[model samples]
Target: MNIVVGVTGGIAAYKTVQLVRLLVRDGHDVHVVPTDDALRFVGAPTWEAISRNPVTTSVHDDVAQVRHVALGQAADVVVVAPATANTIAKIAVGLAGDLLGTTLLATRAPVLVAPAMHTEMWQHAATRANIATLRARGVRIVGPDSGRLTGADSGPGRMSEPETIHREVSRMLAAGADLDGTRVVVSAGGTREPIDPVRFIGNRSSGRQGIAIALAAADRGADVTLVAAHVEDAQLDAAHAHPAIRVETAGTAAELGERMRALAGSADVIVMAAAVADYRVADVSDHKLAKEDGAPVLSLVENDDILAGLAGARRDGQTIVGFAAEMPTDHETVLERGIRKRRRKGVDLLAVNEVGWEAGFERAENAVALIGSDDQVVAEATGSKREVADALLDAIVALRSRP
Candidate 1:
C-alpha cells in the first residue's frame, strides 16, 4: 500500500515522525508531504530520515515531475496527521494551491484526517463547518482526544496517538471503502409524536449509539445514510460535522415511515435505532391547549412500527437490526424484553439494554445483550458507545453470514 502522510503545523508535528516510521515499518510505501509551516516545527531532516525519501514543502521542488499529481495518483490512502484548523479550513473551502492540499484534491483514494487544535478553535462555528464539509466528502476523522494540548489548555484538541492513527490508517487501506458502491440506510434518535405545536411525546434517546454505528460502518467501508430525528444537541453537532453521511430529520413515526419506505427497495442494511412513539395524538390540535383539565383529555392512536415494517417490507437480502431501551429490573427482565422484541419485530437481531439507571440512554457508557431470532446470545460486549457499536456490528455481520 502507498500512503501519503500529510503533516501540518501543530505541536503534533513531532508525532507525525513516529507515525511515518510505523507505516514504513509495516511495509507500506510511505511518502511524506509536510506544509511549509510544519517544516518549522519539525524539519525535513527528520521526515526524510523516517521516510527515506526526499521531502518537499512545495510543488516547486519537482516542477517537471509534478509531484502532487503523481503522489495523489499512486496513493492507496492519504492521512493528514495533526490537521490544524488552518489546513482544515483551507481544505474545506477547496483551496488547493499548497502541495498537500493540491495532492489531496487530486486523489481518488480515501483521505483520513486526525485533527489537533485549541479547544476554542475546535468548537468554532467555521471550524465546525469545515470539519463537516470534509466528513461529507467521505474523509475519515480520527481524533483530537481530551488531554493537554499546546500552551496551558487541555480538552479534545490533542491529536490521537501515532499508534492509534496508524491502526486507523491501516484499517482504511483494508476497508477498500465502498462509498457510492453499496447502499445502507440507518435511522437514529427518538421520534417526537406531536400533541400540540409547542410540545410532544419523546424518549430519552441521545443518538450517540446511532452516530457510533454510522461512523463504524464508514470505517468498515460502506455507503451509509443516517435518518436522524429529534437528535440531541451534541449528536446533531457531530452529525453535522460528518461530511460523509446524508442526514434526514423527522418529527413523527409517520414521517420516518415514509422515508424508510422510499429507500426500502435498494438498501443493503437497515438499522432501526430510533425510539419511535408507540402512540400519537389522534387529533393533533392546531394550537397548544391551555393548561386546564384532568387526564390532559388526550386521545391516542397507534403509531406504525417502523422496525417491523422495514423487516417485512424490505427487499430480499436487506438485513434489519432493531434496538430497544428496555427499563428492566433483573437479568430475566432483560432477557425477556430482548427475546420478545427480537421475535415480535421479526428483526435479524435486537440490541437490548436497560436505561433507567444509566445503563444505556444519555450516558457515556452502556452495556447490551445481542439477541438473535433463535433466542441465543450470539455475542455480548460492554463499554463505551464505540465498543458496544463494534459488538453490535459484529453480531450483525455474523447473523448475515449464517445460512
Candidate 2:
C-alpha cells in the first residue's frame, strides 16, 4: 500500500511521528510530507528515518519530478495527522500553496484527516464549516479527542492515538461495500446489572468483537449505530471518532434492551453482540452495600430477551443476528448448544463461540460459527476479532441475498 502521511503545524505534530512508524511497520510504502511549521515540532530527519523516505515540505523541491502531484497520484491513501486549522482551511478551499496541499489536490484516493488544535479553535464556526465542506467531498475525519492539550487546556482537539488512526486507515484501504445503503444496529460490551451504586454484576466482555463488527459494517458503507455498555475509554473514543458510526451508551441490560428495541425497527440488520446479563438484581439499592453487613440474600429477575424480541418482531426483510457465548464440555457440545439456541431464539443467524476462562471474553482473538435458522453452520471464522467480524458480515450479506 502506498500511504502518504501528512504532518501539519501543531503541537500534536509530535504524535504523527508514531503514526508514520506504525504505517511503515505495517509494510506500507509510506511517504512523509510535512508542512514547514510541522518541521518545527518534528524535524525532517525524524520523518525520513522513520518512513525510510526523503522528507520534504516544499512544492519547489524536486520540481522536475513534480513530486507534489506525483506523491498524491501514487498514494493509495493519504492521512493528515494533527491537521492544523490553517491546513484544514487551505484544503477546504482547494489551495495548493504547499506540497501537502498540492498532493491533496492531485489525488483522488481516500483522504483521512486527524485534527488537533485548541478546543476553541476546533469549535470555531469557520473550522466547523471547513470540516463540513471536507466531509461533503467524502473526506474522512478521525478525531480531535477531548483531553488535555498543549499545556493545561482540555476538551475536544487532542489527536487520537496512533493505533486508532492506523486501524481507520487500514479500513479505508480494504475494498468492500456490500452493506452500502444498509442501516445496521449493533449492541456491544457486557451490560452491568447494578446491585448498588458502586457494585454491579458484569461479564468480562471487552466489547472488542462487537465494536469490530460495528466498524466492519461501517467499513462496508452501512450507517451504523453502536450501542455500547461497559466499554473501555479508548474503545468508546474510537467509536465516536468513526465518521459512519453513531454511538449510544447503555449501562444496564434493561437500558441496552430499550436502546436495541428503539433502533431495531429502522435497521436493516440488527446484531445483538452484547453480553447482556440474563438476570439482574430485583431491588437495586440506592446506597452502597456495606461489607460489614456480611452476605445478604438478594432477589434476581430475568432480564428481557432482546434478541428473541427483535427476531419475533422483525419486518419481513429485516435480518436479526444473535450471539451465544457457551462453555460446553466438549467440541460436539459447542455445535449442539449453538443449534439449540438458533432454534429457540428464532433469529435469522446466530454466532456461537465456546467461551471459557481462557478462550473468549476480553481476548484479542476469537473463533465462532455462524449458524443459520435451519440448524446448519453457514460459516466458521477464527482469527482476530476484526477478521471474524468481516467473516460474519460476509455471511450476513449472503443470507440477506437469499429469497
Candidate number with greatest TM-score: 1
Expressed as tens digits, the lDDT of each residue in 220-260 for candidate 2 is 78999999998998877757877899999999988999999
Clashes of 1: 5
lDDT of 2 at 105: 93
Tens-place lDDT digits, model 1, residues 310-353: 88775777788888888666566877878988898999888888
Error of 1 at 222 (Å): 3.1
Candidate 2: segments with Cα more than 4 A from true spot = 1-175, 330-332
lDDT of each: 0.82, 0.89
Kindly give the stretch of ten consecutive residues in candidate 1 with the minimal lDDT sum: 174-183
Q: Which stretches of candidate 1 lie over 4 Å from their true place?
A: 6-22, 25-27, 33-43, 49-53, 56-168, 176-180, 215-221, 232-244, 292-295, 330-336, 357-359, 363-369, 376-391, 398-403
Q: State which candidate has the highest lDDT.
A: 2
Q: How accurate is candidate 2 locally (lDDT)?
A: 0.89
